[model samples]
Target: MTPSAVDLSALGQRSSAIVDQAGNLARYGMDDVAGAGVRSGESVTLQAPRTVTFPDGGSITYGALDHLGRPTGVTVHITPDMIGAGTHANASILPPGWSGNGILHNEARSHLLGRQLGGSGDLTENLETLQQAPANSPVMSGFEGQIRRVVEGGQAVDYLPTSIYLGDELVPRGITLDAQGTGGFDWYVRC
Candidate 1:
């Protein structure tokens, strides 16, 4: 099936808001996935499908919801026009402070360390504590590698989709375009 063009600008704007909230929660050792008002694990069939527009006249249409009936994910079909010049690859479209690396460290990893060390008094102390802390600490083990993969972005981690998946059925995420204009990267999401 032919993929449709999605406006990166519009998706960036909308996703930025969602990521901002998610990031804040992550920083505090929390996740919107289980917050009080969040929908936990509802069936995907109940949610309505919607079209997400981009600033450059691109758009994606899909329906997604988490367990709690809140929008959780989307599968966007990439088209030639969606990868136009000036479009960002993924979370890169978010503001500078929202880089995947930053979020991994400041939010996910740091929070884990804080719990392990009982809260260090300063950044230096925190680093020192982490340095002195056991390498096998449960919280610090797998996350660094996970963050590295996310920041690097390649075949294992791409923003564009070969297909679209949403809801409970595991639809493809992001956009997919013909091979001609899709030279460098596959796809990207805003942090």
Candidate 2:
């Protein structure tokens, strides 16, 4: 079942510091859980906001690692030039709890900012350990397709993808995506 607005509000508040501005934690809808199927997990966002600008002028802002050294998430500004046949060449620098043979073990060294969206596999803080099902799910791919379409059409998209963890769990329970494009499209998906 979907969580209530009040419940999400309370949950976000009680979790780590999510408010981008000071003294604004009570503004519910601004930071309300984005999707209908959002479950009971801590919501993460761009904690450190460190931007890595590509040669093509596209950029991705990576969040800081949590206390447990887990990635908080990423916000990416994607352009047509940023999308390509992405690489998986660097699997050596993945985070803790990643099985060496991730696909064989039904786990993934997943990217918070997906490689298809110009994210790097080399950054440990940009990676997370995830189950293979959700990592490759149709729902997840659909959201990614929307972002891709906007960028392919020569529009820029500001996309935020957050990894949601339950307590001290090394693997995330789910991911949350918030995307807005210059093409006048906005989407929020939970997968």
Candidate 3:
């Protein structure tokens, strides 16, 4: 009953060639519950069991974009070895609804899984348009720092950062940060 790349397409917009290309890159998690049985606001875990590891050791999975080209959710396992060291140089890829002046004004091309956390800066599937206030504020940075600290200490953490879009809006209303570390760390940061 896990959600495939195509099954996830039904949740928002139709699948496109771009979505297919992104799906091919990351490993997707299957839905434990039937899609039809899912109710609004109910928690849905769309990943396979934790024992199912990625081939690259620390890999990320980006759900296909909705028909509107908005990001759905992004999942990644953060490990110390996978953290990137240099400054992030995002490739020339832009997320949906990107504007040089910002879609909502002051919107930033945010990374759901940051480059420091092993997310690809150039990957379109890993980017989203997030409000600059929260995206650059201490709240977001603090949460990411917590995850980085935990992982750097040699603990493995499973992180899922989801962009919460309201209705058909292209920009996310907020982002829900979920992380669980093997070192007895579990937290959710909604910003």
**TM-score of each model, paired residue for residue:** 0.23, 0.70, 0.66
Candidate 3 clashes: the total is 3
> How close is each model in CA RMSD to the real structure?
17.2, 9.5, 11.4
Please, what are the lDDT tens digits per residue for candidate 3 over residues 109-179?
77767767766566555678765564534445557887898988878897777666656677766665667
Q: For residues 166-191, could you state the per-residue lDDT of candidate 2 as single tens digits? A: 66887766666767788776655555
lDDT of 2 at 148: 89
Of 1 and 2, the candidate ranking higher by lDDT: 2
Model 1 over residues 100-184: C-alpha lDDT tens digits?
4532444221221122112222221111111112221332333323322433332222222122224333212211111111234
The alpha-carbon lDDT assigned to residue 139 of candidate 2 equals 44
Model 1 TM-score, all chains together: 0.23
A best-first ranking of the candidates according to their TM-score comes to 2, 3, 1
lDDT of 2 at 6: 15
Question: Residue 16, candidate 1: how far off, in angstroms?
Answer: 29
Judging by TM-score against the true structure, name the best candidate: 2
- Candidate 2 stretches with Cα past 4 Å from truth are 1-49, 55-57
